[model samples]
Structures are given as structure tokens and as C-alpha cells.
Target: MGQLLDGKLVAASLKEETLQQANELREKGIVPKLTIVRVGAQPSDLAYERGALKRMAACNIDVEVKELDAEITQEDFVKELKAVNEDPATHGILIFRPLPKQLDENAIQYVIAPEKDVDCFSPINVAKMNVGDKTGLTPCTPTAVMEILRHYEINPTGKDCVVIGASNVVGRPVFELLLNEMATVTICHIETKDSSKWARQAEILVVGVGVPRLVKENWVSEGTIVVDVGINVDKEGKMCGDVDFDNIVDKASMITPVPGGVGSVTTSVLAKHVVKACKQQNGL
Candidate 1:
């Protein structure tokens, strides 16, 4: 059976490190704070808000949640974001995306200050990340995947790494991150013919396609290190990952579970980014 990559342990370690940094900053009379700008009360947004709040609290970071109406005008929304960006008290900003049809995200995507754009929503951070710039904050989920690999000491250098997704949020950034680490990276998307053929040859496999149990046992080879970043509800209403864990566990060398895997570490990465932003903003 493959060894389970426990995300809770990784989360705990990150939280502890962030907490220590927060405490030190507090001693220097600087309070690290994150502002979450959310429009409407999306259940998915609420769920992520709760997790971020909990993680921030654990790290001794202050959080401010600004809830806007779903029908708020784009001009008004941009005003609110600008207000937050100009606030010295706000060290980091997290904006829930996929705004209402009334709002044009493209117009305001770069409005958030790059230093406070903790989720890499700003194009500046995204560009920095694409070039392997360690100074900028990266997307939380992809960073969590990298953290899991580090925690497990799974070196990607020169390894055959296959990422089963091409999303800017997860797969693409992960591909870049692994490539930065000198891994031979291949990214497969919806148009890729015979994804499994590539997957079977990977020494490391990372899946974030959001399809439940999409990667079957045949997709992975023996001793493959599998990282499932997908979180979905199976037909039975149970939560699951892209890889069918039960079927692939015995064949893979190491695997991450659905609920306790990448998702669990994401909030911690958010906290880490906030702390980092705080330090940079304060010139610490």
C-alpha cells in the first residue's frame, strides 16, 4: 500500500511557523492583517471564508471581511477595493473571484495592490510566479501542492512529472513550480489525447481537473508519487479526489487523501502569504 501524505501535519507546521512570525512582528508593534473582499453570500465563498478565518486566527493574524451585495455595481466595487488597497492597516487582500455577470473582472483584476494581493490575483504576482520569482505570492492551492512535496521530501529534480490540468489556478502554476525545481514537466488538458499514456510514465503525478475519480488505477504506474488536488462530490454524495484512491493506493508509492490533503494545506498557505506580505510591507 502507498504511504499516505497527511496534509494536516504540513498545515500544522506552516501554521506554527506563521504564528511565530506573527508573534515576533507583534513584539515589534506591527499587527499582520488580511482583508477579504467578497461579493454576495456564495456558499462556496462562505466555506472558504470560514477556513481562511480559522487559519488566520490560528496564526495570530487579524482578518477583516467586507461583504458586498451581489448586485453591487462594478464602479462601486472597485471603489471599495481601492479603499482597502490604500489602507495601511491592511497587509494582505483576498478577493473571492468569479464575480457577478454585472461586474467585469478584467477591468479591476489589477486594482488590488500587488503586495497585498495574497492570492496572486494581480497580474504582477502571476507574472512573477511564471518566471519562478520567489519574492511574489503565488496561488494558494499550487503552493500547498509544492509544500506537500517538500514535506514528503519528494524531490522533483529531473523526475518525470505529469500534471493533469491546465488551469491558471492550480495545474499550470504547479507545472511551472515543478519545472522551476528542474522536473521534466508535462501538462495535460481537455484536448490532450491519451492522457493516461503520459500519466503512466510519470514519476510524479498531480491531478487538479475537478472530476471525481477521473484518474483510474491504470493511469498510474508502480512507485508513482500521486498528488490529487481535485475536490469533488462523488455520485454517492461523498467527497473524493481525481484519483480513485482505493484502486490506486496499492499501486502508488505515496498518495494524498481528498479531505485531508491539498485542500487542508491551502488555508495555511494563505496565512503564510499574509505573513510574508506583512513583513514586506513593514520592511522587516
Candidate 2:
């Protein structure tokens, strides 16, 4: 069996550190707050909001969930976003994704102020990340991936890395971070002719393609490090990732499991970003 990279343990440590920072900020009369704007009652959105609130409370951060009607218009959505963006008391803003089809997603993202855009979905923050600026916030999942790597003392510099998936949220940002770390990166997408060809050659492989068990043991080289970012339900209704854990664990040196891996660290990273935004807002 390969070494398991446990995200729950890492996230707990991060939460403890964030809680201490929150207490210190409170001493200076600064309160870190996270405002989650969720439109509609989508089961996934509601579940994520509840989880975020729970984690925020653990970090001693204030959290507010703004539930909007599913019938809300684009104009109204923009107005609500602007209200949260301009609120000095709200240090971080998270707008749940896949809003009702009636609203324009791009326009909605454009309305958020870069400073309070803790999710880093705004174009400004995305641009800042591309330029290698530490001042801008990074998307939580990719940032969490890096945190996991750092926690395990895995350095990507000079390593042959392959990132499967090119979405704005995970694949792209992680690829950029890997480049920043001086790793040789190859980003593969669904359209790629031979994803396994590149995967087998990589010393470190990060899979986020969203298809359950798309990557198997034969796709990876011996002793390679695998990070599975996909959260898909298997045929048996059990949660799994893009990589086939049962098959790859024996061949890989280190690997992260689905439910206990990256998913566990995501909310904690969001809380950490809230604390960082609060510190900057307070000049602390």
C-alpha cells in the first residue's frame, strides 16, 4: 500500500492556525467575516454553504448565507453582489457557482470586487495569479493542492508533472502554480489524443478530469505521486475520484484519496483566505 496523504489532518492544523489568527485580529478590533451568496435551493449549493459555514465557525470567523430566489433576474443578482463587495465589514465574498440559467455567469463574476473575491473567480484575480502576484487570492482547490504538497514536503521543482483537466478552477491554476515552482508541466484536457502517454511519463500526476476512475494504474509510472481532485459517485453510489485508487495505490509512492483528501482541505483553505483578507483589510 502507498502512503496516504490525509487532508483531514492537514486541514485541522490549518484551521487551528486560522483560529489563532482570528483571535489575534479580534484583539485588534478586527472581525473577519465571510459572506456566501447562494442563489436558489440547489442541493449541492446548500450543502456546500452549510459546510463552509461550519468551517468558518471553527476558525472563529463570522459567516452569513444570503439565499436568493431562483427566479432572481440578472440585474438583481449583480446588485446583491455589489452590495456584498462594497461592504467593509464583509472581508470575503463567495458566490456559489452554476447560478440559475436565467442569469449571466460572466457578468455576475465581473460584479465582484477583486479585494473581497475570496473564491478568486473574478477575472482580475485570475489575471493577477497568471502574473505571479502574491497580492491576489487564488482559487481555494488549487491553493489547497499546494498546501497539501507543502504539508508533505513535496517539492515540484525540476519534476515532470502532468495535470489532467484544464478548467479555470482546478487544472489551469494548478498548472500555473506548478510552473511557478519551476516544474516541467504538461496540461492535458479531454480533447487530448493520448492523455495516458503523458501521464505515464510524469513524476507527479494531478488528476481533476471529473470523470470517475478515468486514470488507472497503467497510466502512471512507478513511484509517481498522484493527487486525485475529482469527486464523482461510482456505480455503487460511493464517492470516488478520477484516479482508480485500488489499482494505483500499489504502484504510486504517495496518493490522496477522494473523500479524505483534497475535498477535506477546500473549506479550510476558504477560511484561511478569509483570515488573510481580513488581515489585509485591517492593515494588520
Candidate 3:
């Protein structure tokens, strides 16, 4: 049986740490607050917002959700962001992605202050990440991946790690993070030739291509640690990861399952960023 890298268990532990930090801040009369700007009522966005709010409440972090109309003008959205940016109580700001077609997402992202961009979607944070600064709030999903590795006591230092994808959200940031840990990182995209050759040589394999069952059993080496970051709905309407979990489990030393894995850690990591931002803002 493959050893399951249980992200729920890991996330719970991280949440406990965050709760302690929140309490510490509360004692100092500084309440860490997170404000979420959600542009629409898409089911996925709603679900994520609900989950984040619950996590924040459990952590004793103050949170406010700004539900904007889908028809809101781009200028109005920027104005709202400016208000949040200027609010002393709001230490962290998150803008749910894939805004209405008429809105300019890039312009909206730039309006958020770098200090409060806990989502790490702003160009300033991206530049910090690329240059290997540990102080900046990183993209939550990639940070969660690092947290999972730490939870498992699997350091990536000097190891051959293959990240299969180059997306700004998951793939590229993770590759950069692994490199920061001194890992020999190789990133593969859709056009890569014989990608399995890279995977087969990796001590650690991370798949985030967003395609269901894209990484097969033959692509991985025995005893390799596999981290699946993809969450896809199959033709059968079942949720699955990029890796062929059933087939790859026996060959892998450790692996994360889709529904209960990386997705579970993401929100908690975001909450942690809020706490970090609060600390930095207070000079604590």
C-alpha cells in the first residue's frame, strides 16, 4: 500500500499554529483581518469563500467578504480595492479570480497593495518569489506544497524534482520554491518531448497540468514521492488528479490523493499568510 500524504491532517496542524498566532495578536490588541473581494456568484468561488471564512473563524481571525455584483464596472472594482488597501484594519486582501468578462483582471490585481496582497497574485510578490525572497507571501498553493513536504519530513534539497506544468499559480512558483531549497528542478509543459524521461529521473514529482490522469504509472520511478496538484472532473463526473492514482500508488513511496490532498491545505495556508502580513504590518 502506498503511504498517503494526508493533507487534511497536515492542514489541521498548520491551522492550530495559525490560531496560536491569532491569539497572540489579539492579546496585543491587534486583530488580524482578511477581506475577500468576490466578483460573482460562481459556485466554485462561493464554495471557496465559504471554506475560507470558516477557517478564519476557527483561527480567531477577523474576516469580511465583499460580494460584488457580476455587472460591477472595472473602475468601481478598483475603487473598492483602493478602500481596502487604505484600511488599517484590513491586513490581508484576496480577490477571487476569473472576474466578469468586461472587467480587466490584470488592472484589478495591480491595484491591491503589495503588503496586503496575501494571495500573492500581484506583480510585486511575483518578482519577490522569482528572486527567492522568503519574506514575501508566496502563492498559497505552492506554499502548501512546500508545507506538505515539510510535514512529511521530505526535504527537497539537492534532489532531482520534476514539476509537470508551468502555470503561474502552481507549476512555476513551485519550481522556483523547490530551487530555493537547492533542488535540481525541471519544469515540463504540454509541448515537452518525452516528458516521462524527466519524471522517471526525479526523486520528487509534482503534477499540476489540470488534466485528469495525465501522469501514468510508467512515468514515475519506484520510491518517488508524488504530489498531485491537479483537480479535474472526469467524464464520469468524478473528481480526480492529474496522476493516475490507482495505477501509480503501488510504484510510489508516497502520494497525495486529489480531493483530500493539496486542496485541503490551500485555504489554511492563505490564512497563515494573513497572519504573516499582520505581523509585518505591526512590525512584530
Candidate 4:
């Protein structure tokens, strides 16, 4: 069996580093604060909020939650977001996505200040991330994947990397990150032909297509490093990753489990971003 990439241990290490930074900022009389804007009460959103709150608290960062009504109007939502953007006290801002049907994301994406957009919601941050700018905040999920690899000492440089799914959030960003590490990256989407052929060629495989168990044992080669970024409920209502862990474990040299993998490190990445935003905003 392949060595399990333990995200919990990586997350703990990141939290420890972030906590130290936050303490240093505190000594300089600066407190890092994150404001979370959540609309309605999505189960998933609430669950994430709980984890974020816990992580931030552990890192000595403060959190302010703005729980908006489910039927909030676009104008009101934009107004509220702008208010948060302009708040000098706020160091980082995180907005739970897929806002109500009435509140269009495109119209509001730019409302958050880029400096405080800890989750890379702003186009400015996205552009910076695309260009491999280190000053920008990256999407936490992709950063978590990188953290896992870093923790495992898995260098991507010059490796044959295949990323399934090209969504802006995880897949594309991961591809860019790996490329920045000098890895030869191939991104596959639904329209891509012979995707499995690409998968078979990968030294590092990142699956984030939201399809549970989409990658089978034959999809990977022996000694391949697999990172599953998908969180989906299988037909039986059980949580599973994009890759079939049971069958692929032996084939992979290293693999991350779903619940205990990338998902676990994301909150710590968010905490780390909040501290970075705070330091940058304070000119520290």
C-alpha cells in the first residue's frame, strides 16, 4: 500500500507557523482579523465556517461572521460587501460562494478589496495567481494540495503531472501551481479525448472533477503520486474522493484520502492567508 499523505499533520504544522506569525504581529500591536460573509445557512457552508472559526481561533486571529438573509437583494449584498471592503480593521475577507439566485457573483466578485480577499475571490488576485505572483492570496484548496505535497517532500519539478478537471477554483490553479514548480503539467476536462491515457502518463495525478471514484486502478501507474481534491457523495450517500482509493492504493506510491486529505488542510491555508494579508496590509 502507498504511504498515506496525512493532511492533519500538515495542517497542524501550518497552524503552528501561522500562530507564530500572528503572535509576532500581535507584538507589533497588530491583530489579524478575518471577516466571513455567508448568505443563508448552507449545511456545507456552516460546516466550513465551524472549521475556519476553529482554525483562526487557534492561530490567535479574530473572526467576524456576517450572516445575511437567504433572499438578500444584489444591491444590499453589494452594499454589505463594500462596507466590509472599506473596513480598515478587517485584514481578510472570505465569502461563501454560490450566493442566492438573485445575487449574481460576477456583479459582486470585485466588491471585496483585493488586499483583504483571502480566498482569491477578486479578479486581481486571480490574475496575480495566474501569473505566479507570490504576493497574491491563492484559493485555499489548491494551496492545501501543495502543502500536502510539500509536507510529504514530493517535489513536482520536471515531473509529468496530470490534473483532471479544469475548474477555476481547484484544477486550473493547481495546474498553474505545479507548473510554477517547473513541473510539466497537462490539464484534462470533460471534453478532453483519451483522458485516461493522460492519467496513465502522470507521475503526479490530481483529480478534482467532483466525480466520486472516477479514477480506477488502471488509470494510474505504479509509484504515481495521487492527490484527490474532490469531495462528493457516492450513490450510496457515502463520502468518497475522485480516485477509487481502495483499488488504486497499491498502485500509487503516495495518495491522499478524501476526508483526511486536502479538505483538512484548507482551513489552515485560510488561516495562513489571513495572517499574510494582515502583515501585508500593515506594511510588516
> Cα lDDT of all candidates, in order?
0.95, 0.91, 0.93, 0.94
Q: In what order do the candidates fall by lDDT, top score first?
A: 1, 4, 3, 2
Question: How large an RMSD does model 4 have?
Answer: 0.9
Off by over 4 Å in 3: none
Local distance difference test, candidate 4: 0.94
- Per-candidate TM-score against the hidden true structure: 0.98, 0.97, 0.98, 0.98
Model 3, 1-284: lDDT tens digits are: 57999999889999999999999999999999999998878999999998999999989999999889889998898898899999999999998887889899788768889999998878889888888887888989999999999999999999999999999889999999999899999999989998899999989999999999999999998999999999999999999999999999999999999989999999999999999999999998
User: Cα deviation in Å at residue 219, candidate 4?
Assistant: 0.6
Judging by TM-score, tell me the better candidate of 1 and 4.
Answer: 1
Tens digit per residue, CA lDDT, model 4, 1-284: 99999889999999999999999999999989999999999998999999999999999999999999999999999999999989888999999997888999997887889999998889999999878888999989999999999989999999999999999998999998998889999999999988899999999999999998999998999999999999999999999999999999999999999889999999999999999999999988
lDDT of 2 by residue, 136-222 (tens): 889999988888888899999999999999998899999988888888999999899999999999988999989999998899889
Give the better candidate number (2 or 3) by TM-score: 3
Runs in model 4 deviating more than 4 A are none
